[model samples]
Target: MNQLGHLKQFRSSVPRKRSMGRRKIEMKTIDKEPARLVTFAKRRVGLFNKANELSTLCGAEVVILLFSESGKVYSFGHPNVNSILDKFLVQNFLPEENVPKIMEESVQGTKNSQVVKHEIMTELLSKVGVEKKRGKALDQQREEETLLGGEWWQGPIEDLDLPKLNHLMLSIHGFIELAMAKANMLTLGTKNGCK
Candidate 1:
């Protein structure tokens, strides 16, 4: 055979090695502290970049507060974290009349508002804890489904019967309504001193 034919035969005989690159990681808690730390660092940067892009692209304000396993705080904001937080608090908690005065007061003496800030921070942290619990529960449910070799919501939509579809729709609608009611109540409570 000619050299070209021999080269083709040799290439066919040699098994091509798979690409040596990062493998997909399963969604789970990383057991190793060092590996977890590294992953957190990398993913945190990625998350911040995505947040920044979203803010820029959508002309939306964004604020991210992250706490590492070691309790180190990392934050990112579009304009300024304090400004965004102030806007959120003003819009959600403080009355329209109190906004300017409160801002002025906070600016005049940081110590004067420390207690109020602390209380607000505590409330926000509690909310975060509640959200974390909810997320953990969802994660646990997904894990259980995976272990059982089935995901409830992953199959073809056309496969669902009408009753099943209607039940799912009703369940989702109820959930949305309940969540909205809870949110409205929380907002009212915050407006009324959260007592």
Candidate 2:
């Protein structure tokens, strides 16, 4: 095994009390560059090994961040710690004032859509009213002609048949009645509980 591997293997083999002096020396001040570097390397390896053991035993993710004496940074993570931390921060770390702004934007979009739908419905209702008025006027004109020409509705209005005109009037009346019923349903739904 390498020096770090040996250190990790021997670390637990030595009792805690027995290794405390050297562990402190390893972590704290050291006289020589070689000695401190060696300690840092070995301890870092041992720490990573211990982290792996903890992760395996407890079914947990592990991450480690270390800064060397020479000012370089080292990092280790089991499953993209930075991404998970970023997601956590995004969900849980927003300022209170920012929340109201997001809510206001959502409300504005909903209101705009509702207003557009209302305008469309209003236009359709107006068209229905216009059509209904036109149908009533045409029915009235046909009824007047039937009264004036007593036998004019017999075959067809174009051929001046009074009975045919009467039947045509009845069909037109039935169609108008169905149209008005449908328009009333639409209007009622608009006035009552509907979206």
Candidate 3:
């Protein structure tokens, strides 16, 4: 029955504000000349920006050509359109059926190798995620190494909590198994003849 109660009541009574952000634009032609021109400029800028991002982030070569209502040409390319066009032309000069390609590695053998893989782009993005996880694991390992002054072998079995003890047991089992395997391999030769 005080100012706090009044303030809470007042706050509850007030309506929520609407979001002032981008919304869906109508997919119809603008009849007005000025409006159309403005829209074209804005859309062109957005298109070019996206192309630049695609080129930069994915290490892709891209070329975009746009024409205005008045026949003015607008173009955007990462490493110049002419070079890309030339490469394309050289690769495609002979018809696909006619040309017998020699199975030689590319001079820039990076992107060419991945072209035949299933969902290569998705794989590449997944690799980024894996690298990020690996980087975090590496950082954590470095911190632990700094704290322990070497590989983290937890000491004083009694000091370890239940989960830590369980983890330690698992690690010990793995080490024993690995040692046993190496001992067996040393005593007995492998199927492929161990190097």
TM-score of every candidate: 0.51, 0.34, 0.38
Instruction: Name the runs in model 1 displaced over 4 angstroms.
Output: 1-19, 96-98, 105-115, 124-195
Inter-residue clash pairs, candidate 3: none
Model 1 scores a TM of: 0.51
Residue-wise lDDT of candidate 3 within 1-195, one digit each (tens)? 899999999999999898878988889999999999999999999999998887776666778879899999898988875455334433433245422221122233445533522243466578769967866866786687678675444466667678656656766786796797687656433332433
Q: Model 3: which ten-residue window has the lowest total lDDT?
A: 98-107
**Per-residue alpha-carbon lDDT of candidate 1 for residues 50-139, written as tens digits (9 for 90 to 100):** 989877766667899999878898999988676777767876666588688668756766765656666777987898799678668667
Residue-level lDDT of model 2, residues 68-109, one tens digit each, is 999887766665445433333334443465445444543466
Model 2 has an lDDT value of: 0.64
TM-score of 3: 0.38
User: lDDT of model 2 at residue 149?
Assistant: 72
Better of 1 and 3 by TM-score: 1
* Model 1 lowest lDDT segment of ten: 186-195
List the candidate numbers ranked by TM-score, top first.
1, 3, 2
